[model samples]
Target: MNRWPLWAVLTPGEPARLERRVRAALMLEGDEEHGKGPSFEVIPGRGRYHAIVGADSSDVGAEFQIAKDLSREVDEPVYAIDRGNDPWAVTSWRKGVLEVLEVDPESLAESLGCLLPGRELPSDSSSKRPLRKVALVEGIRAQEASRALEDAGDPFPPGHYRFEDTPQGLRVSSETGDVGFADITLSERLPDVMAYGVIASPNLDMFFVNVLRGGECIGHFALPPRDDSFVPAVRDIKGENSPERILAALGIPAEWFRNE
Candidate 1:
């Protein structure tokens, strides 16, 4: 038998309470209301989760909604697992928070590292497989690298993205606006560096301004502060984490950061 491509994973305070909310989220009086074998189900997950299963888990469907809704209701962390898709990702929601992650080593390690601060992932592949499996999901990209954001609409839809180079800095543009990778970000990817970081969000709601070297902050202040970065800001105004503020701080031309 085939496995459900996607399901919600939760470690809840009360399973019975959660199930009731799940039923309500599915908008059914009972399981059979959907006219399928059963409209909804929550089973013991393979690991430390109660996997909430339903007919369809796509964002357009009811399956994933239960995961996010219940997390907020119970003040818990709920994850939506999608095994049937590419660049597999774990959709997580807590309170009103959300993040979509792809199932790769470096990035997945970052996600786990945050969850288990100061802990390191063993080098063995077997031990690392679970994190990879659960975090597996499609990556966020804006538009084909070939296209540009021609409109000024809000809530830009996620699609293919393009990375452009300009005199000011690197540009990660989507269908709606250009996400600025300020000069500091440009410095991170300088001609020679052992490794670096890139932080972004699908809708450009998040961005970071930091230049890490030898595992020291030496420069910026970012939110939810990363474990390995001790960077401090120069006592500037708030919102420096934003593209516009970041660009303003650089004293560079703004044409590259703003939507053309």
Candidate 2:
């Protein structure tokens, strides 16, 4: 199992949003053919987020060493691929370097040594699996509902979703969006909200940033704070009044804007 660290490039107030943005960017940038899943973990007193791949609890020390080494070049939250079959890859939210590593004990030693600069890899059998499964209905419902809103519009059409209000819990699934490219699934809520963010799609660009409950942005992207910057997109400033004007101000193409 391998673990990689991601250093977020934003302030503390918006870790959740920033984490989502970084995850979204990875989705947008990664090769769909690879079938890679993005999984993350949060650590306190660590200035950045960690993206562990094929990692087990035993590998935390080694993972931290590798992350320390990566800190020199990776100055932002990045997706690090650590499958034994593929060379590790890291992106700093730019067209920057795309590193490839040969899967060998020496390479692992070198990366850790270089990144941690004389640190040691953790030695424990527990470094077996880092990915976990979530089991919750309301949490799952919220994710599905959010995705549904992203697919069509806010307050998703009645028939569009699957909602079961049983004594057990609430469950929701959308027929249209679930089968399309706008696919998103929810397992359970992440207790570490401090390290997560809300998901938003670029299509929300039309609403001029007005996000209604049950609605979310298309695709996910990290939302880190950096020098008070703004994208100037439709979402920057939007409300009930003159929402259309905000869209117009963004110069959204006619094809991209839809009332529904």
Most lDDT-accurate candidate:
1
Model 1: per-residue Cα lDDT over 1-260, one tens digit each: 02332333444544465567665554444445546443345554334345555433111123344555666765556666533222333556687455444334224323432211122333543222211100000111223222222221212244433444433333444333322211112222232321122232222233334443322224443333332221243333233555456545433334432222
**Which ranges of candidate 1 are over 4 A from the true structure?**
1-3, 30-36, 45-48, 57-64, 102-260
Local distance difference test values of all predictions, in order = 0.36, 0.28
| Residue 154 shift from truth in candidate 1, angstroms | 17
lDDT of 2 by residue, 13-101 (tens): 13455445434433322523467543333322134442333232112112222332344444553333322111222222222322222
lDDT of 2 at 241: 29
